[model samples]
Target: MIIKKTKTILATTMTSAMLLPSAVLGKEDGRRVLEEVIVTAQKRAQSLQEIPMSVSAISGDMATDAAIVDTTDLVQYTPNVKFTAANPAYSSTSIRGFGTPPLAQNLEPSVGLVIDGVSYGRSTFTNDAVFDLERLEVLRGPQGTLFGKNTVAGVLNFTTAAPSFDLSGYINVAEESLDGKRYEAALGFPIIDDVLAARISWRKRDKSFGLYNTTRNNEEEQFKDESMRLKLDWFPFEGGEINLLAFKSDFESVGNGMQHSHITPSGFQVYREADPQTEDDEFNNTRATNAPTFTSRFSEAIALKMSVDTGDNWVFRNASLTAIASRAQVDTPYLLDSDFGPVNALSLETDGPDRYKQEQFELRYTADSDVLFGWGDSVDWVIGMFVGESHATVTQFARQNLTGLAQLAPLIAEGRGVPNAGAAEVAALNALIGAVPNGEQDVFAVNYVRVFAESYALFAQADWHLSSSLTTSLGIRLGKETKDGANGSFANTPVPALVAGQENFDNEGSKKEYEVSPKLAVSWSPSDELTVFGNIAKGFKSGGYSG
Candidate 1:
């Protein structure tokens, strides 16, 4: 009996307004006291309750308890956030129902990701491991006024824990039943009594816990990951500090356990008549494939961050200046079966090494509760300038087995009113196409893409406290982006007639775009427990080339 059941599943992304940690409420001598949750959603540190926008702050301890290991896990905890991934290179994140589709190599991410005050130019880096973090903050709605371009949806901000003056360390290990194991460790110590400190964290994970592949007689969806981060802090002067951060990660996966969820009657008939490896296809944890498939990626990054306080001596009182410079790169190579079946139909692989590199620099000034343009001590202001450049190279090649296509040659012959066009003719045709029916791989097509991009931006924000219970904020950003792209496609088959009508082409183009984003917000706090806030913000995304 085939039992078909249908049910609606509503996934509600809960807002954290009322879901703040219970630790926020405390009782002392029959009096209610609230502990503040601090956040830097606006590029400045402030109480979460005082921010005039939607934000969710999750501490590292809470993340550990929730088993949030990577950016994908964050969707379950943050409201209006969604994540999907076929692989690390094809992960997509959405906020407020806005997100780029997976494998959209031509478009930038709708939601931006920033770590330790450094913005990652590409979304592919979102799959890196999350460890030893101080806090994770999700800022909802358009954040382009503060985060610059590519934040039309929202932003995910990660802050790693700073090295402590006191020596401290911790280790965590876990194991599962399906040959899964994870190890994480962190250490922090003072290199010099009061001048320097260092902290380091490392993690390793191996998992083989997915569907079984009957064709290969092995487990599918197996992966291994390793990551490490190191931080150093140096106090150069009374109110100046310098920080160095380095990070590295390696990840590899074997199989994805992909299978068709639905099929039409005619399609099923053709699939079965040709070479159907499995008969069941209804949410089954089994896949049938006879191809070598694997994906691997290695990433490295280094950043230098410096901050200095003016100490009430400059034009702005109680102001601080911060600067950051960062460099990052990701190298990924992968191969996969395009036809997910037992038949050696087709495969896709990288023609050579694939790489993406980014360099960024930013300088900002922040004044806390200081007078701005003679506005008294109720206005806090921030201004920053950012410059970035990136380069990406992606090359793809397709290999095909003519036997899979030859399986349908007889049907085509019959349809054309040709009587008794036997298998011998099909074999000859395959040979003429520079392929064989004996499951030999032949180059079918190759596509190469190269992109270089540069962007410069200036952003500023000011919050004015009209009264003890009312505040207004205004922010704006002006940016310009330039991109140069080159693309080449070639049909590499020997016989033009057998390979259809595909032509080789080479294209190159350059473009420049300018954007202006502005934001205005107002917040009213009637009491410590009651607050109302609203904002109107403009967003922008730069243009790009299609792969």
Candidate 2:
């Protein structure tokens, strides 16, 4: 009996492996060299030691060369993946801690992104634009019976650079004495010599930093980015094939707002100190600061692919993609202002100010080795279909200061809307804690994303020839999630809707969910370099709740 096994689940993306296949154990003189690394993770084409699972592949020239320019250098080469840039326009990622609360678009990200093959609703462009790849496949577990749900926590695929019938591409430069500079270029030949081929690329970078300014002068600010990509291929006759991809990017920055804790006076210590006005609350002094911030972003994407190769065995494929993204920010923060400088002053506030844009589309399909199985010759299976839509808009505003004007006399004779009292005195600073209103409400606007019903799944894997040195195989999947949403079309108002009969005001109109995902494997090759494996899986993420 031949059997291989593996178990993967680490919350998502390059985290433990999504779109996976990771196995690299070393020993040179002691003799041991393992390198199988091949996976579509069961969509066919196996050899990650014949599939047990836990995948991680990387190389966009080590993710944008010259000392790694993006994706936080891909979290130390993927191992439990976690990130918190919080600035440079916010960043959030986690795997194993199973996260979703990074710049919340109503919280939705357990990890499932695919670039190049297109499928990334929002990972803030996986740490904002910067990838020129040939590999980046991380697939962990729970893929909703073959990628139907939001992947519970797995999937991060990006496969670029494909256009070379015989012609190369490369150009790189670097600089970082603290003024970080980088430039990259690529080009591939053959336009129509053998049915057509093309490739084009470009990238740029600039960065500068130093925040606790000791006259490091440019004091925390500077990082510019630019990008471009293009690829095309057609073999017009050879069983048929076509591929096209595109990309664009622009990112700008001038940082600030990365400070945590220290408003002293509570048993304060910088080597001993208690009350006595505690030196007027000194934010742990570091040359105290104020004002200087800005962030901006713009992105683009396009993809098209077609496949057919009926020379025998079996094959067919289809893909379509699209994207347009936008982001904006404005910041002017200076904290610890216990009224004014002595220890905490310079308040020039601007916060969570917002602006975001989005556009997306998807269509996919693939099939190989149509199995009617005799249970030998290593059977295979794969199927697909998907669609998408999105939109977002947000706004924020704030202002207040008439020097508290004697605490506004009984909240202005109890005549105006109290609580941070307003009506001219610099105006409603806390509008009763919903925050000062300048009115332009339409936050979290996601008009629609209806796919209704078009989900079909069927998968199978077998290789029961487990003798001659073990090789067991297995696979299973079932799915459904026809999409639904309606919080009364967006907006559920009721400050006092039911009358005196309050019991949580029941009249429900939008809430329901269902899903099922499964997978299991076992493998043992034992020769041609050697092998062993293990895997167990289940992944699905689709539930709704937003207001």
Candidate 3:
């Protein structure tokens, strides 16, 4: 009897433990009902089911559990979305098979990226690490109606956690076998009861060795990344609130992540003889290079947002006014090995500092009235205006190394009627040739480009509740964009005669374009559990210079 009682007790304990989570998850009669999600995909808070569009949302907890640290990691969970990146400066996001190539720096992105109501003008901004987020939202299809310009494909919206009156915090740490580690933490507290609050979050990551470099006896693709964010909320008066946000992010890499997957006969004979470890097998994680490469970016931004709720205004009831202003800057400095080999051949580096700066402001008004001039029982409408300016400067240099020139001395000598030179004589001649200025130019060419852009847009959207179960929405946007840019390539060879065939050009251009985008959508909900929606939208993108 004692043995039987012990067995029964063990079984009961195991069953209770297995069912505890389900019981706490709001199970009703053994049926688990999913929690409702609220989103701002249409510029207002509504249930995810009520949004008449294709949308996806990932909560902060889910993202943390899945180890999603950047925009690229979201592809696995979102359908018809893909991300491609050769480096931080060269990255692209495609939705529904529509995307712009990342090589065109001056061009606009087809997909828009917005964080806390500030839209990023460039796609490279997507490379920044994301942490302490409340939720991430992705809207597929054209979003030009309310999102303004350059949203030909879709939009990505990130909403960070706000300051709370309660004290809360969390720390997360992750480690791997390959010397990779990540640390993240966040804290929120009330500074002065319910009137003022603040929240801060940070993340740091580093990897010592992700790939081997046999020629230099070092590692490739080693990187360190860190990001910090601060948020403050102040309620100074009745029906008014202000939010201040500041953030900074930095990423540094020692070497570019690249390797040879195939080798030609001549390449194999040359590279293999120089370094026996050189192989075409990319999976081997080995590379041969004499030129050290590097890439780094530092970005920072600050935003101020204020909102006021107007009660029973003369022309509007239950109306709100919101305004936001933000400024941001990003600097990317990089070096590249042009030859990608053991030979001390050609290289490329930024000639000077590369900087991109932007500023933007937006003002919006939303009103929900019980009666809309007898048009419907209830109606909601939104109107907004946006203006922004951006400026960028980029300069680069292509350099030729002396050792690379020495390797070609013998061949040049042979062509110059000195074919009978022996091995010792050839070595002496090579050394003499490399020591001379005429052998190779230190600065082969310099590429310089500058771009400036200004834009203004006005947009409006309204939703009419025709009946208890039917609704319709119409949105339109009018935008004007202007761009001015200058680009030039100059040959700076020490001996101009040596590069007589080098091409050079200086060009300047400007463009002004106007766009009109509109959208129409309809939805019918017969019950709370089901909603059917359909929409058609148009998109546009302005023209710009690229090289």
Candidate 4:
């Protein structure tokens, strides 16, 4: 009965955490329903209700107080959009199940991220703090015709709120059981006239620990973590904007928990512990022994955009962007619980962990009317040149059987002036590199986010009106890509190798094909509030290994 109840509680907790990102709506015309959404998949705004794509758009207002912490939150609500929270610091995510498990930073994202018009790379960049987010637009289908590389899978675009001409701000605070807290605040005041304005925001999540009941003997039998972000916005002109945002965070959770610390057969309750005396004083004995995991991350980005109307039929837009980011860690991790405690605790050492950075610039000209061209009464076109450069580094560490319980048990026992230590217990405490393995890795890559060659890209597109109710469009993009990586293959790893050899492993491999995906779409509106549209697109994921 106790085991059943525990399982039920865990399921319930997970369900609630997954759904907290959603909300209930007020009674609407005698019907209760989810909110309608708007999206900008093609680099232009459009009502999601009118688009045929299966997209999820979490608006500014909805995103603010929701449980959706970062890009990973989308997995709970979207169908076929799955992700594995491989670790608190890293995750593998996909749309339409298109992404292969990620292996290297150079292996391009199956799904891309765009923030304030700048592309965000894969790697630690995935952990960039969320803040001052005005809106998060997730385009679920292929967006190849509009967005360049990686759009073959889809895109996640984040637009920060622009500075308000008026002075206003708000703060949010929340607390949860098992000891948890989160505080976020943003304030925007004019730094200049309406033509120029500035805004800033900050967010933080202090260290909060979780309790691990009597289980696999562990010197450190608890976990806690922290994260934060800061953002700045500057609008120097009515039609042009500049944004500078920076974020940093560190997370250290001692005992990241095991699947089963004390699972007994059938109806029995077993007694297993790492020496209750030591764990009971975990917090009080904070000279910092047995903190199994340590992680840290830092990221910053700058973007500038300028848009000016040349005439009634034409507009010109120019943008420049730069970003730098990294994630590093050394973890004493355990694997595969044997229904009692960790079956294998491995010591992992990592350094200069992973880094990805880029600088980009773009120039695009768009027109809404046919007045500039003599071919038709209604037509539009977008031709642009984009230049981008990036350099990155990735490192993976070696793992060795490691545990701190026996070592700490003796210490706590000795501290209490125990009469003597058992011969078996004394022999259980030692290894090279402190029961850990050391590893080294280095890789450099230059990839383009838009408009040109290796580590860069350039492209153009166009549209035409066949008649008042029917329209046609065509787009073409040409680019280059590079990916390079070397890691201890999952095949060479004892655990994964055994799992792969015995279990049905379905993870896909890398896609080396240079992609060329095009799209075709149509829209017909018969009523003021309704439109019917359909589209067909070819999309692909850059495949690779994952460990």
Candidate 5:
């Protein structure tokens, strides 16, 4: 009997209005007011009401109240945002129907994720657990110029809380059904009063699997995760400050709860569904898989930021200069059942270790007078530069059972009615059967891939306050990237003909690409309660070789 079934998960995103202080309002009505939200969506600190863009900001308190632990949960509170996980190591995201599939390691994400002013290059980093955050900002639409490349859809920016001079600490613990438990703690204090401060935070989570494995007689997809962060702030001199952050995380899981549901034969429209009671069920109520799966990941990062304020003494009055440097590393390994059946047929394993580093600097000059650009204090601008590099190495191995293939070949031949099979065919079958020595199959294939990428950009954005009610903005970015890749694969088999064109394959390649993205926008505030804006922008994503 052949049966087919499909399953889907419904996702939702929400937006809530914030109440600002009543002092900003002209009249004191009984109506509840919304608080003013300040954000850096345009690379500067400004009131959300002043910026002419679609943005959603979530405070740390809100995230904690809702138990938002990861990007998947964070998206549910933002409008038009969705997150899908293909596995523990891969995830895809979309904003306003514009997104990229996490189909391959070399594929770049359409959305950009930035933390503490440092941009993350890979989608895998999006899965990092969230903790001790000051706020989270989701910027919709093409952030072409100021945000740089790979932001065709939108940007997710996270800002961690800064250290305070006053000593403070907090701890939280929670337990829920399904053996889920969480613990988090944070402490902040002054190292030197009014000059230096530090904050430290840690979190741990343990959860049981959501699915039951009948074959193993245990719950699958169990997980344990730990994360830590340290932050420091220094006020070296008047109008200057330095901030540093370091973070580390470790995650391990027994299984991902992926069940085999169906098998389809070649040239057949119908497929046979795995029996729910026989180790191939796909329902949430009952599930079964014969193979043991495991996954582990570890990551760490460090970043430094410095900002200096140059008073009206310079020609570029009220000037502020900023610089940032950061480095991060990630390592992951996993094993899965390739055949997904009670019968032993195949297994797959992969190990990957990746490193990423970046350096950035920016300088913004606000006119004290109409001396420099003749626009006076009505115009403000910023110029910046960025350089980043990433290297990744991945190894994969697969094992297949020759005995199973040998047992199925005769039936296939018989079903096809091939009388007096040729000697070559018989020899091939004998070779396959013979390769399974010592009651086990041989290694089917081993593959390796390494990629190194380097990228840099020069960008600038300027805003012109044409009048009290209107503003105009223009921005542009010039970026270039280069990548080098190396790949090789080897297959094991006794039959020389069967192994032909499958062993000792190696290749190396390189590519270089450049792009220019620009943006223009106009905003008008008709009243304190209403704002209108329109923008035209170009989006770009770099191209790279597939693994």
Candidate 6:
């Protein structure tokens, strides 16, 4: 009876396997076969099953099939991963219940994002549209040894399709509801036959606003995006390869459909809820204003990687070295309705604009040798050093109107109908208005914040095989980070006495921190089909001031 049950289970599994796509499944002897997945979770190419860490890898084809254009779409398919977007320019990603809020420019992300082996310092850049990808690997846990600092949660690695020697190209077009349209295309060919190759890709997206504004008799939340990338590969000589990448992206959007839920006792209000599924046009409160809310972002990046082989030796056999350099810049300008009501209570805009720049350099060496006193067949190890610098400038301006203040003054005055109901009140209001040069809306506050950071790290990891069936790995990373910041605020009000402590102020500070992360893991494989693994690791994320 037990044998019959086992046979039934195996048959069911085989039937399910046959139903899967041929690209995801292998065929051998006219039978369905499970294919092995290759990954670089440990900074080296290896089979997914051979790695002892928990990881999820999604192929570009699978992403395209699912119509996944951004990081938020990945949450639906990945377990223990969550993505939240405060706006198109800011997002937070969490893995294993560890994450940070994307509220300020000075804050750092706990989860790290890596593209083509170069790490991104800011989470704002992670939500960009994805195109021409080879694979995306989500490594769950503290990947401090291989990825360095700010990887307390995990690491997301995106590998783009490489340039091919053969001519190849593809074009994809998609249309969706709300007049949304998307186009993507790629082309690859050889420039110097087997010595050099190039690939270029382009993507564009346009979508209509999903929310209707009854006050304005129009819509909000519309967006248009465009991006392009170029990649080049050169085999300058034997045992050496060089890769160069350049990318540029631009994103533009209209007002967000954020709505005001409640007003505080002091007439202060904030956005609390916005329901996109609601068909009622009046549900969203937006004022009809000549100044349309706008958000624009432009980003550009350049990266280079070179890999060379160093001749073999008794201690460092099969040695190879890799070097990487990358630089990126982002600029953004935003304007929004701060009150979220159908009245011109408060309007917020960037004082000037927001700007960010980052640069990084890394060098890594890897080898397979009997460095562990000839303990096993071979010892695989890697060592690397990284240096990075980032700078950010952000500013905001809030404008408040007398019309909005009058709407709230009545409620604050108890039985008073309006600010002009009595002669004394009218005179006081007139006096306040006269204090302003324009006798119109005044700048409530001007906030300016700047941040500068520099970081350096040394990391190493090694795997020692106790025997053919058992292996152990040890890794460590030592890092130091320093940050300098300035936050200043200037309040422009008609009546300064009424708003105490709202004067001009400036605060400057600096911080320096160091951390050491370590990891140990053991894996035992008694048979080819079964393996058991255990690991212990420590991780930490850097801290910074809130602007």
Q: Kindly give the stretch of ten consecutive residues in candidate 2 with the minimal lDDT sum.
A: 493-502
Q: What ordering of candidates by lDDT runs from best to worst?
A: 1, 3, 6, 5, 2, 4
Off by over 4 Å in 6: 1-23, 210-221, 258-291, 408-431, 438-440, 494-503
* TM-score of model 4 vs. true structure: 0.65
- Give the runs in model 1 whose Cα sits over 4 Å from its true position: 1-25, 30-34, 210-221, 259-287, 368-377, 408-441, 494-501
Off by over 4 Å in 5: 1-29, 210-220, 258-290, 351-377, 404-431, 435-440, 494-504
Compared with the true structure, what per-residue lDDT tens digits does model 4 show for residues 1-547?
Answer: 0000000000000111111123346577898654545456556555555444555656667666566555566445556676555554455557766653554334556677676566655534554435666766666666655566665567777666657768978888877554556666777777675655556666665544444433333444343444444444555555444555544445555444332322233112111133222222334422112224444444455555555545553242232222222222222122212122222233343434455556666666665654235554565666666555555444444343324333333443454666564334445433222433453111111111111113334555555665654455556655555443323323223332221232222232222225454656555545544545556665434333333
lDDT of 4 at 416: 60
User: Could you report the Cα RMSD, in angstroms, for every candidate shown?
Assistant: 7.0, 21.4, 12.6, 11.7, 7.4, 9.4
Q: What is the lDDT of residue 156 in candidate 5?
A: 88
Candidate number achieving the greatest lDDT relative to the actual structure: 1
| Candidate 2 Cα errors over 4 Å, as ranges | 1-37, 43-67, 72-102, 110-135, 138-143, 151-154, 157-378, 381-512, 516-541, 544-547
Q: Which residue runs does candidate 4 get wrong by more than 4 Å?
A: 1-38, 46-52, 65-67, 70-80, 102-106, 123-129, 212-241, 249-252, 259-291, 312-345, 371-377, 399-453, 483-515, 540-547
Query: Which regions of candidate 3 deviate over 4 angstroms?
Result: 1-26, 127-129, 210-214, 259-285, 370-373, 402-440, 494-502
C-alpha RMSD of candidate 3: 12.6
Per-model TM against the reference: 0.86, 0.30, 0.86, 0.65, 0.83, 0.86
TM-score of 2: 0.30
lDDT of every predicted structure (CA atoms): 0.78, 0.48, 0.76, 0.47, 0.70, 0.74
Error of 4 at 17 (Å): 31
Candidate 1 lDDT for residue 413:
61
Instruction: Tell me which residue pairs clash in candidate 1.
Output: none
Candidate 3 residue 478 Cα shift, in angstroms, is 1.3
- Candidate 1 lDDT over 104-162, as tens digits, reads 65466888989888999777777553788778888887788889888888898888888
Please provide, for model 6 over 80-109, each residue's C-alpha lDDT reduced to its tens digit, 9 standing for 90 to 100: 888887675666888878877766555667
The lDDT of model 1 is 0.78
